[model samples]
Target: MAITSIFNDAFVLTWDFILTIVDAVTPSHPAGHVVPAGHPGAGGEWPEYVSPGEGDSRCACPMLNAMANHGILPHDGKNISFKTMNETIRSTYNFSPSFCYFVPNYIARALDKDYFKDTFDLEQISVRNDKGIEHDASLTREDVRFQPDQGKPHIPFINELLATASGKDTSAEDPENALMLTSDDLARYSAKRRTDLENIGGKLDFIHKMFGSSNSATLLRIVGGHVSDLRPFLIDERIPDKWEPAIRSRVGLTMARFNLTVLPLEFSTRKHMKALAKAKKSG
Candidate 1:
């Protein structure tokens, strides 16, 4: 009986050791999807783009939608864990680790999701609220009051902004006709959008205006303010083929760097608004 008891204890210990080894080898969250070969994060080719189908969720943010379209996020746009978002954004865009974490946490808090464990469906971020990320006068979205389906791209509005690009660069060797949007172009476009929305009795409060400014700054920083690069992402909700972030740094685009970019735009936006106001007052 003593020998039998000793053997049972030994077996139990062996089984526990095996289980620990298995746990160590397994991933906490299985991807459950095919990562393309040689992809950045999990190693694979860039996933093919697919439009969101009926009952598949989408958000007002074009960046997230583009990521989902390319299977960087879940293609179905459902139950996206914050950790998954952080990892993918950092790998895909080479954004700062801190910024990547900050965005997801900000969304979770704004949308009232469980910051620690709650997963967000893409559509949840589309909710229009004062605190929510989606707001009026978006670069790729129509005002909430004007458009019933704010999740989809607003092509005409986007084209209008694209037309504001300074002009094609004759100096570039490759992509012979590369168009660039300057800081001035973005500021003017942002100011014009605000005024146009106001004319139509659309609401774009200070918070929303700041959000729009931040997005403009992100666009410039990530894609180098190139109209060619912006087109596919803004209009088609697809990442440009072979896209690499223009901002290359070990720390990536940090919050301080991002803020520095945003401040000038904010100042420019204010300047444009004042000019418009003065013109109107004089007229």
Candidate 2:
């Protein structure tokens, strides 16, 4: 396992170096036009939801899948260019222009594709290698050890996540109700998932753990901070009706802002997991 991890790290580093060179030489694509929120071209109202059918490509990432389902991305999930992905994500989610580019660049490096010329199919992002972007102990998908097909949602796990909000103050009458998962709630849940995977001999490495943490933070920040809003997005891979971008800013969410949210959550999750393991050992 140690040797494999080392190899994976080296491979990832090499890919990153290669991509840096390619990106340096590649001319930037013109910024795609942004449609106004709530307009026909924007993800707000007009685009009808369509379920992915036979031969349609899908991926392990729920957000991307949901985008494809909502027609914010190609319904067929094929031949997606970085420029298209960047514009769509920015317009739909209100992510910063830099963040929009950052994600596609990361995906390109992870999937070993050229960021400039090569278009990617969604299924290409589902590579199960340990160093790849897709990892085990996902919030809504079973680990690859148990289910090779990680592209589909795991209903049981989604149910477990929703259960965290069950007893909270979800009163519809109160506008400022506490129906959402707090940072601690999300951290505890993430710790539990990590522990469960470890007990089953499916421990995640540092890269995978960081990826999981980023996913959680993205859910908390980008997706509606409420668990109720997350339900359809996770279970059905559908964007909720009347959904609006949670964070609205001209600059949008930058890498620094995202890391500020993720780092503390990751630390808290690790601390909780350590406590759980210590308690188990003492018992």
Q: In order, what lDDT does every prediction score? A: 0.75, 0.75
lDDT of 1 by residue, 1-283 (tens): 3475457446544654454455445543322222223554333245788988888788888888888998889889999998898878877765666677667866876777765799989888887766687777677788777786777889998999989999566766777348888888889988887777767777667777778888898788876777888998899888776666666554456665677788899889889978887888899
- TM-scores, all models, native as reference: 0.81, 0.81
TM-score of 2: 0.81
Q: Would you give me the overall lDDT of model 1?
A: 0.75
Ten contiguous residues with the weakest lDDT in model 2: 26-35
| Cα-based lDDT at residue 126, candidate 1 | 80
Stretches of candidate 2 exceeding 4 Å from the true structure: 1-43, 166-178
* Lowest summed lDDT window (length 10), candidate 1: 28-37
Structure candidate 2, residue pairs in collision = none
Task: Give the Å shift of residue 202 in candidate 2.
Answer: 2.4
